[model samples]
Target: MKRPSVSDSLKRLMAPHSIAVVGASRDPAKIGHAFIRNPLENGYKGRLYPVNPGGGEICGIPCAPSIADIKGKIDLTVLVVPAERSIPALRQCAEKGVEAVIGITSGFAEAGRAGAGFQRELGEILAAAPFRMIGPNSEGIVVPKSKLQLTFSPMFNAMVDGPVRIMSQSGGMSGMIASRLAKRGVGIGALFSTGNEDDINTADLMEYFADDPGTGVVLAYLEEIRDARRFVKAARRYRNGRAVVVMKGGRSPAGGRAAMSHTGAIAGDDRVVDGVFRELDVVRIRDSHAAVDATAALSMMKWMRGRRVGIVGIAGGFGVEMTDLVETSGLLAPPFSDKVQKKLRPIMPFYGAVGNPIDMTGTIINQPDMFRDVLNIAIDSGEVDAIVILLTFVGEPKIIEAVIHANEASDLPVLVCWTGGGEDTSPACQMLYGKGIPTFDSPAAILTGLEALKAQAGL
Candidate 1:
């Protein structure tokens, strides 16, 4: 029989037909209990087998005494047992021919010298075993589309389906990114928390997501890179086709020390990492919120054709501010050409400016179509490659509809920076999000999103 390739194993690991939970517990307080309960609650379609020495039933499902007792082929297995017990449990999985495994138990590698020895033993077992493993200290995986909540995270309850995929070394950071994106009305297709990377490292998953058609953007949170060569190769494969936004930790000496203790990962020099990322054409963002903003934009917007942005706003002051932001963000805000300016003159009020920013003044409050007209003109013009609309306290449905219509009718990316108006403007924002248009609450976030889109487009 042909041995399954690592990619094949990863496919099974991501969307398993049958899963076994080793150390499945009846106690609700334990992570073992959450592992089984989460899948059951989330409507996982796969067959589930919970293994426990003293088990009869867990979460209303029959429990086997061990993986050996499970009668059928298991595609994936999750181990939540103690570190000392993980070795024997893994040996049982190897004997049972499990295709993939996730060791959720901590204590090995990250727990100092004694634990390192244990990790070495586990590696030896995997070397001879047919199945590949994710981690001995990992939080496991979550595939929202498959209803595969393999981890014990409570965030799964709120996760929606979208094109963004998150892969992080820190489980907490992974959940944090997912939650923040969710709050912004952006959803993730899958989340992979590669805890200790005992076997399946970041580069492996990067290559996997590179081929995942459903994923449009990959949001990664990294503490360190274990294999630079493999990482660069995988990144290059994906960079041209999909947007790869990375938020790297451990830039400082103090942060580096913390990262070492947290994941047993050695932090690389920041300058070298930055250079490698730049060479790979990867988008490296330092702030978590900004990273999510970038991911959301990349997931929603089309690739920008160029760095020239057409800024349109209801207020003149914000138009000036956004012009400054656009120029500072390495984006161009050139004045509209004579023909483009002629097209905009009639739509603008006499008091309004009809230059690059195109401040339509307060006239748009009564004439909502003005917003859409300006967008269409900007998009149709050969001058700009993207459009950014600034709305302050204007939440009319017609105005929101205009933005959506303009976005759908053009290949150019349209972004909105909506401030003030509180609840009145929220529905407009939600409507834009529903139509797959990128919207931001602040000017800074909008620029970050635009920068990400430009970078991904290689503009």
Candidate 2:
């Protein structure tokens, strides 16, 4: 019989009828505990069974000894036992007719020859059982709609319920990026970590998210392309007129060696991989944060009507730096027209530079209203499709407020480069974050983030 596709498997994985935790533990530090606690704490709307031979009730919930002892059907099982014990647990899950299994235990093929043999044997056993598997060394999956977090990352936040899905190979990177996106109130429909590539791959997740109604954008972090041709086909199909940003790691020989040591997967030609991404209209990124920023921007804003960008900075030096970066990035900082200059001239103080990269200068450093006035003129004048406001750390208490108000007022996407340190870093970062504005510490990070947004908008 023909096997079902990954899209079909993900359906059962994301919204299972009954879920069982095979290695449930009482300790909160264990991955098994996270797998069990996250779902129940988040108010998972499905039946949860904890399987442990020595288990009594955990968190006031009854624990079953094994899958065979469970009364009803089991749709999903998370195996968190030692590497050697995973296959037995999987066999038990298969016997109970469980549709899918997510193995979070590590030390599989990534370990060595014996481990690779163990992983292959496990795969062969699963093949006959007609069950879909996520990983022998994966961090597991997260589905926010069900309020389920199967990974052991505490940084995961359940914020804005947007139409974006993230598929990453690094668990730590995924958690960090997800946390950053959550701070911006950008919701993710699903997040999956494809560690070791033992069974499930990124291509499967891309195809799954393509059909998912809740997913409008996809952010991918890949070290290798297991099936490059098939991945491109799925990526093109899922574009949805939106963007798919991919960050391919393992570029240099050193990086490839490190990646191989981590996941035991071959690192392919990075240049050729990038070419394929360009051919398929996939926006390639350099870092995980770039992927997150691009996904957030593209998921919120539409394509730019024009590539002409306007720079509004608090100082001339910052504006010059921004211009250099933007121009070098294949984007243009077209000169503002005479009419735009005339309109903006009266609002600014006498010291401001009023050219393409308009410099608001030090006059507005302490004034909150100046932030709003300059952005309003540029957006209202139709001279620019996007605006970048460079702000140093010397602004007033409500400096972020001014930027937030300007962002809300303009239809065009706004980028904020907040540089400096003050009494409260959390509150200051939170204010801009609350409004969905991208804030960066360095000018280079700001330009890179904006460039990603530009690519997503096809500017």
Model 2 quality (TM-score): 0.86
Predicted model with the maximum lDDT: 1
For model 1, residues 8-107, the per-residue Cα lDDT tens digits are 8988887899999999999999899999999889899899999999978998998999899999999999999999988998988888899999989998
Which pairs of residues clash in candidate 1, taking residues 3 or more apart in a chain or in different chains? none
lDDT of 2 by residue, 121-240 (tens): 776876676678887678878888777777766777464457778888788888888877776666778888888766678887887777766677888888777676778878888554
Cα shift from native, residue 127, model 1 (Å): 1.2
Clash total of candidate 1: 0
Q: Model 2: which residue pairs collide?
A: 160-187
